[model samples]
Target: MLNLAPELAERGIAINAIAPGGTATDMAAEHTASYTPPALRDVPPEPVIQSMNALGRLAEPDEIATVTAFLLSSDASYITGATIDAAGGWI
Candidate 1:
């Protein structure tokens, strides 16, 4: 994105990306399922998922949505050629 930023800038376009960690969504659920056997499906996945994150919890969909919204808003107009980490400080 940074490589093309200068060129895209002339056209009033901004390019950036977000790296979200451990978000609570269907894709995450499916990935988690592969890590656990069917016999353990009854167990809550929160604890397991939290253990993998520094924040000790998975992010809600709205949390990611908020970041996305901000990126699209004028508040982030000056932000370009960067990848925002929305991982709750994951290690």
Candidate 2:
């Protein structure tokens, strides 16, 4: 995105990305149950999350959606060539 942003900006286009940390999604739920090690999987997500990020919990889908909305809105017109960290202050 950083590379293409300047060129896209010439056409009045914006390119950005979101780096989201752990979140409660179907994919995550499924993966956590099957893929995560048994020891870690059985341990409630709260402590694990606390170790990974400040929020200490998974993000709701709407939390991510709100960031998307803001980026797409006119309020963010000046933002480009950037990655928004919608990770609830994950380190």
Candidate 3:
């Protein structure tokens, strides 16, 4: 995106990306149910996974989508060649 954004901007096209972390999706639930670390073998994975971010919770799909919508909207007219972090403050 970084490389293409500049060239695309010349044609009035915007290119950007969103890095979402720990979203509360079906895939996330499946992965949490199946994976367990050696040290945390006996521990439940949900809390451990949630603790990976500063918010202590997974983001809803709409939360990430909101960011995406903004980037594609006129509100973000000046934004380009950038990656928005919609990670719930993941560490």
Best lDDT among the predictions, by candidate number:
2
Model 1 ranges with Cα > 4 A deviation: 38-44
TM-score attained by model 2: 0.90
**Candidate 1, residues 1-91: lDDT per residue as tens digits?**
8899888988989898999988889998888788888899899866776777788888999999999999999999998898999998787
lDDT string for model 3 (1-91, tens) is 7999999999999999999998889997778667856676677756876779888888999999899899989999999999999887898
> Rank order by TM-score, top first?
2, 3, 1
Candidate 2 residue lDDT tens string, 1-87: 799999999999999999988888999898878878877766777777788888778899989999999999999999999999988
lDDT (Cα atoms) of all candidates against the true structure: 0.87, 0.88, 0.87
Which clashing pairs does model 1 show?
none
Task: Record all residue pairs in model 2 with backbone atoms less than 3 Å apart, i.e. clashing.
Answer: none
Error of 1 at 28 (Å): 1.7
**Which of candidates 2 and 3 reaches a greater TM-score?**
2
What are the runs in model 2 whose C-alpha is more than 4 Å off? none
lDDT of 2 at 85: 96
